[model samples]
Target: MPEAALPEPVRKRGRYRRRLRSRIIVSFVLLGFCLTALFAFATNWARQRVENQLVEDVMNRNLDASWQSYARSGGADVMAPVQQMRAFLIRPDMPDRLNSLRRDFPEWERLQDGIHNISGEDADGKPFSYKVGVRKTPDAWFFIAYDMSQALRGEQQLKRALFFSVIVFSLLSLVLGWWSASRVMRPVSDLAARLRAYRGGNAHPEPLAPRFPDDEVGQLAEALDDYSSRLTEVVQRDREFNADVSHELRTPLAVIRGATELLLARPGLDEKVLQRLQRIQRAEQQCTDLIGSLLLLSRNERGQGSSNVARVAEQLLESHRAQLGGKPLELELEGERDLVVDAPEAALSVALGNLIGNAVKYSQEGRVLVRVGAGMVEVIDTGPGLSEKDAASLFQRGYRGTHAGYSQGGGIGLSIVSRLCTLYGWQVSIRPGDERGVIATLTFTPG
Candidate 1:
């Protein structure tokens, strides 16, 4: 059977069976079916018992009457009963109670060996059963036959009663089910309305209404409300953080941009001015890198969008290789297949770029081998690497190690990578460089 349509209450109360009416309906149907089956069994048992007793009574009576008749008349023909009609031999009350004379019922007559027979009705008034055939003495007989109109009438009454009961209870169940469903659905509908207001196209966590504090439905509402309210608080905190990022980054960028512009504006300014411009430009780049890392952190927090991991990684590696400027990054791809992950392509690029860039920046100008494991990316640089202190918190948001050296980014690169990896179920770990510099590995998100 097709499933019943979900009631409005279940939609509000829960995604499935959460209404009192649903439970009651299910329980009632099961109970009704079981009771009906049991009733049928009991009725059948009683009916069969009564039928057996009735048959036994008739058999005994026939045996008694036949023995008496035979003892009195040696082998006399059985008497013709009431109505005296020609349509039947033993009219009116045929010798239905006697077995031997049973064959002649509705048309009975004694036969040889003191036995006779007659026909009778089935449960449904259809002619289907045969009456008894019995011997009264060594050579005398009697028989009986009749219709089952009484049994048929009783069965008909039972069927009608069962039908009426089902109709009445079915209607009763529907009314009860509907009312119970509404009662269960009330709080849920109210909660949903409140949720729409709270979410407001964003995660605006709102506290639950305090009116109902301890009921089951109330508990659910309170939990959802608490979550929404927490969401709003978190959003506020993030806004503050993003604003702080902007304020912290503007000063250095302004200084570097202004210094570079002033010297470049005046054509052919001297060699000393040109050299100063280079340092300013480098500082400006570092400030931009720092700001970028902070922005990447926000994107990772929000799960902004998706990206093609394999394509993005390949592109970033190609760009980083060019910057090697003669020192090669020995590349090793562990698998023949490409790996895909649902993440921001730019964040992946920036993260991988930072690890490789750091390797190049800190190394003693040597080869930085990059290895892509089955589920990870490893960057091993040739430089005098970190101590235990540095490795412990190397990927902390702002903590830089003693040997981290001054890099373009303000220490947020590895942190962003770590945060993103955590959020997307990836793994990230680092150890001292392979007898050279740093070796950082980021396990890609499992597909």
Candidate 2:
């Protein structure tokens, strides 16, 4: 699609699934980073606030209890079950002064420090400064210690949730990608099917069903229709020209043949008359050959109806072999015998006949080898090898090599052979015979 044609918003909406997924991931990560940072900082600040409040509450409770005990019962067991009660506010350590008091006259001096904090942060093991609690009691000391291990663990769990979200989003991206790609290709695939039908000689491209009437692919389909129409026009014109030429030549060839035959039938012609008749006969023969060749060429160019290719191959081979007139040849038929091709019987026969005939004409005493395979017939001639130039242009229309001087009709046979081969979607090759002779081979392919 043209970039300018797509609006900025539409262009930004990428159809590429992988790129879309990557973009989603990047956005997710950015959001996650900002949220995680804000949340983590907020959580730490809230936790610190709660910890300070808890420490203040603990100090006030202990001081009140100690003062009541000393005033009412003269320093009774105020911090009853000291080990359990002290663990609530103090770490598993005691200063030298507090230890000495606990062994002798203990009246809650540890709570007298007035609630204070130790050096450390609540998470990631960072050090934090201390804070003192309300200093109402001179002998009591208060301390605060915050462990952020729990907060860190909570953040890790949040990270795990984020990762899980990413995975879910990625899967959704995959499904979206597949659906988008398939939708885009649907029109193109339909256009291709129509083009294939047109190529197979079915309906014209213009009449083919349009998959998407207003899309770029629809425009391509229209172009194909235009091109196909022009091609059909050119082909019809060429066929008409061929038919006209073929029809026009027939009448003159008939007159020439009739005149030549009448001259030959004259009774007891003198030497001069006989020579003239012979010349006339030669002229008639050339005219007949030319007319016949031209007619076949025209029919081939105009395209003949397809027939049973296997039957054509078999029948043409049998008839031509018999016509070879006792020429030494060996036939090798391999692959499937049910091989079928789309071509006229007559054109294929003429092409194969010419190839075989040339091989026999050049074979001398060596056996002519004919091999039949799937859509292919090869004729090998153990005769003079072909030159590089002859191999290249031997199949060209009316092209004849030096060897044509020795072959009949000055090598028109090979040129005709090539035309018929082309019409039938077959290929012909002439190369060194692998010994001291030439090899002429024909290979056919599915049209």
Candidate 3:
């Protein structure tokens, strides 16, 4: 079925049943990952900045010390200031040593008073990185190189450790989220389970608030208990009212039935009086059937019996025939007679009676055909065809058709029929006839 064609409550339920705990877990995981990622980025940035400043400072100091030592010794002492450092000096007067230094370190001849970073393969084809500080003087140029291979390795290990820490914390967050969600949802889940357990019977269920702590869940449970109590009271009162009304109305109807029967049995009575008495008896019977059906509807229960569709339709047609008075409306029953319904005669009577009554009431000079089939009965009327709005909402309570102007009815008969059909698992629908009037079908075998 199309989703738009589904009932409102069903559509709402389909849209809103997502799991809350799963949402909580996903939220925690994302939060953990983002926080850890930001922390790792900040830590790596700070470490890089501090390490570069410290290494540059040490290189500059060592280069200055080497320059001073070489100048004081008149370009004699060529040793580097730090153990992990190498120094080289080149003089403008010594062409042999200058040529050798230029050949050995071709890229470092453009010496200025600053620290520079260099990284490349060495003579042995091994990768090397260093910070080089240069000092230019009138006597010579000094170059001091500080090896950075060990620091580079340590930074790589730290980066690996940070990456693993992020992963570990993210996993820990996931586990913590799962545990927290479970703890938070436990009472709500229990409340739902207990509510589900109280599904069908038990008008007065156990109090849910007492079983939970004084928290949000407990408050919800308390509200539910209050609502349930009020709802139960309302339902109980409605059932009592229906029972009382049925009992009270049946007494007068029974009296009328007895009086009508007595009058009907009298011999040689006036034809008009006899017909009136018979009509009165049928009216009483109809009132009784309507009351029984309404009572069943109010209680939302189905009465059990075997009802012959043809017989009930025929009786309804006959009753409507008498009520038609001088109107030129012809009532007829057609089709199969073997169709039986697993519903009480009163329910069937009320359902079919409303259809036939509506047909008789609406048609002025045409026929009303009640056709019985395998698992369905159709009441076809040759009255003015119903409008689109009428056909759509004909069975809604208090809804009168457009053609029902000045009609002596409150528009509840068809609604009762609809409720009866629902209680008995039947389907009822009304539509415009092929040429004129309306066709109302009641199907006992609903899909």
Best by TM-score: 3
lDDT of 2 by residue, 1-447 (tens): 111100123454336524644554555555555665566566666766786687567656655665565457643334422222342222234476456647643433444446544344536766434343333334433322234345456656866665665655556555665666567666766776666655434334455425458668778877776777787777668768867876787677778778878877889889877866666665554444445545666555434556554465455455445445566655343345575556555566666667766666666566666666666766666766677777666665576765656555566777776666655556766667667566665666743
Q: Candidate 2 overall Cα lDDT vs. reference?
A: 0.57
The lDDT per prediction is 0.59, 0.57, 0.85
Q: Please give the distance, in angstroms, between residue 413's alpha carbon in candidate 1 and its true position after superposition.
A: 12
- After superposition, which runs of candidate 3 have C-alpha atoms over 4 Å from their true positions? 1-8, 11-18, 73-80, 83-152, 268-275, 325-332, 355-369, 380-415, 430-439
lDDT of 1 at 239: 67
Quote the positional error of residue 11 for candidate 2 in Å: 34
TM-score of 3: 0.79
Candidate 1's displacement at residue 269, Å, is 8.2
Better of 1 and 2 by TM-score: 1
TM-score of each: 0.46, 0.45, 0.79
Score candidate 1 by TM-score against the native. Answer: 0.46
lDDT of 3 by residue, 173-284 (tens): 9999999888988898899889888974776778889999999999999999999999999999999999999999989898999888888888999989988898898888
